[model samples]
Target: MIRKDRAVVWGRFVRTRSGLRHHHPMTRKIEEAQPTWFRLSEESWNEIREAYRNGATAKELAVRWKVSPSSIYRHAWEGGWSKKRSADADARAHAEAIAEEERADQTRPDPEAGLFGPPGADDEAMLGDPAALAEQAMAASVRAMRARLFVEAEKLARLSEAYGRMAEKRGGPAVTIETIDLETLYDIVMNKDGRVGERFRVDPDDPGPRDPILVRYWSHRYAEREAFKEQIRRVRANARKAACRAVGLDPDAPLPGF
Candidate 1:
């Protein structure tokens, strides 16, 4: 049993009905009673420690627990609590964000993408597969060759148009001189009165021909057209070879019986 108005220095003194008496649970004398206002229970201290550990500030804890911020501060100081800098935390978060951005970059589309092509552009994945890469390489090479061919064809058309304009001015008929893509087209055809000194192969395989068309319709321009045949042959070599082989015609032996 306990009595009221008893000073409890660990409950060491009490005033009875007869007189004041001395008592100690452990026989130790305490001069002053523990101040109840400043003291806290083990359960309450445990809660405070937990709240501080889990990111509670002194002001936050003070308001929640109905205590002074000073008290909360004192408790935290004794418990050795500290809050990490907000900047440091933000930096770490941004570092993770940058890492994620790099991972996405692995598949990000390049604006200047070409040469081979973009991944999955046409039944070809541009990653980690040798056979698909080889096929795309071949396709890119073919595209380049065809592009050059188209450019050459456009140039040839321009030259032919120039010949047509020249013939209209001279009142002469359109001739085979317009068939060439030569830079010398204008120079050759400007003098049509000269003899046509041009010669060509009767057969690609034989390389034997001494015939000349020494007429008004043939000249250096005609010779140029004959020479241009060799250029055309080179340009169509691959396709012609493929076609010849497909039809059982020897590509190196020229057209048979010609």
Candidate 2:
């Protein structure tokens, strides 16, 4: 039996009257009075130790277990729990993130398929011949570029025509310039005429001798289009040379089946 003010600490009751005392076994000190805080059961204390070792913070465990954070820290120190649990948690999280990124990469779409379109049965058949594979890749790349150029050129023409109509309403020239069709522009650019200069020429400062704003707009876009085409050309050339070198062939020599 115990009084209201008297309580048990470690199964030893506090004194109900003066001059009666209890002592701690390890500390070997006479107990002054029952502490204000409550004690956790052995099972709960064991769980707290395990949680602390596995990266749970003392304050977090204290809140969850309804104990003082100081008690949690004291118990951890007594139990020899590692203080480097936070660092271990961070390392674990970093490893998981890297694994997740690798998993995402495995499921990601291929850029080559997106750009040059999916390979056909014939392209699959050319896998054994590196030079043939390189040629096929280049051909696919050129076809894709041509298709994109046609679409963009048509869009530019429509924009130019719309601008012309708007100009007419403002009492200006009805059309700023003649809108060239995609085929005519392709021929003019590909033929390398003096007016065009080169196949992949990109001179921003000089939109050429053409006076029309249409030519200037086309010139700007053409430079961008040619830049992409040149990149493809360079990539193909390099890939072909690499393929040749891999087979112990002369890289500077003419490519096979050229």
Candidate 3:
């Protein structure tokens, strides 16, 4: 119900009559059915940038976007994108933006236990969880012990191999402690005749008596090897105890030996 004094142009209700039906100057523009071109979305902005990178002219983009080139130029300038620019500049700017984004990511506050880490994440947080702490402690202790044992075992293997080879060469199945003295024992195991005494010959033409220092050297080597084996035994025992205690097991309790 429009009053006779009011006229409706488009949605505006002006004075109406039966003879005056279509008389709007702006109606022709609407009648042409122009597509929407205002308030570009972020996706549209990216598309504009992509088009510019692909060397598309502003006129082409304007035609595709249903806007004037002037609008395209204004939006591109404000968005920090350029037209008629070299690909090198585009790539350089892209890399810089990526680096900037990476920097921002590093600065972003990433709280532990947020999604990836275990719950109760904080300094020494594992100490509060007995099970977690025990597991970690046991794992660390076992790793250390295993590494030590690996090195020691390799040394022992080399020593045993050398002793076996030397024993075989000396026509003895094994080194025995049945010799009369330490010097005789060393000589028997070292492939030297024990009966070869000091001044066995009278003349310099004959081979001089076996060097007295050889017995001393072999005796010291034997003592050092025995001591090293004892030390290895004590270290292994302590390592087992420490590992056991770490996992809340009794250190004195019998464990499956490695």
Candidate 4:
């Protein structure tokens, strides 16, 4: 029950009823009809601000906290939270890409494993037999060549897909080739035979047909793979010749080709 001396204006009781002279229930309800403004505690506001700066969107925060997006955006603006969001988002994307690449590297099969050696072919046991060594060497070389080509083709497919996506963007940065590692380039040059080097040589000086960077990397890698394979062939052939002479057979005899 309200005292006769007190009057209610809006929701609060006033000492004087100067303007609101009559205390009618209907008038009091109408005056107090406005909804209360939503507010967050200081601690909750700080948490929201930190989340916004750390790459969380205002809409996401609103849904998660059961609050309106306007409220989150308001606090975000007042607290200067928008500037860091894009930077944090980029950093998160970079980190995720690095993690995905590491995982792929871990799961990928090693292309160079057993390239020069046939499965279950003992080099020592075959040393006494010239024909056996020659056949094994040829089969091993064929298998190694096929493996290398398969890996190169897989890389090219993936590179093509990536470039296709990049092409969809207008006014995007031009695709750039990375500098070849000096040590790796040196190794490729040193291992090169006349045939492989001439066929797959990577000429950075070439001006026309500006292919993507990954295509250039693929060429360099293919050249290196072929050069290494050639070196293995020569080494294996010499070993077979030595074994033929040791077994009292003709060293210069033509080896059987697969």
lDDT of 3 by residue, 57-172 (tens): 77767556655677778877887675456578778988999999999999997532132234454537754444444344344444444656455444444444444454465565
For candidate 2, the lDDT comes to: 0.64
Could you tell me the TM-score of candidate 4?
0.23
Give the number of colliding residue pairs in candidate 3. 8
Model 3 lDDT-worst window of ten: 25-34
**Could you tell me which 10 consecutive residues in candidate 4 have the lowest summed lDDT?**
27-36
TM-score per prediction, in order, is: 0.19, 0.26, 0.22, 0.23
Candidate 4 overall lDDT versus native: 0.63
lDDT of 1 at 138: 51
* Cα error of candidate 4 at position 248, Å: 70
lDDT of candidates 1 onward, in order: 0.58, 0.64, 0.60, 0.63
Error of 1 at 49 (Å): 1.5
On lDDT, the stronger of 1 and 4 is: 4
Better of 1 and 3 by TM-score: 3
- Which segments of candidate 2 are over 4 A away from where they belong? 1-66, 78-80, 85-93, 110-116, 120-258
Candidate numbers sorted by TM-score from highest down: 2, 4, 3, 1
Give the alpha carbon lDDT tens digit for every residue of 109-131 in model 4: 77765555555647677665544
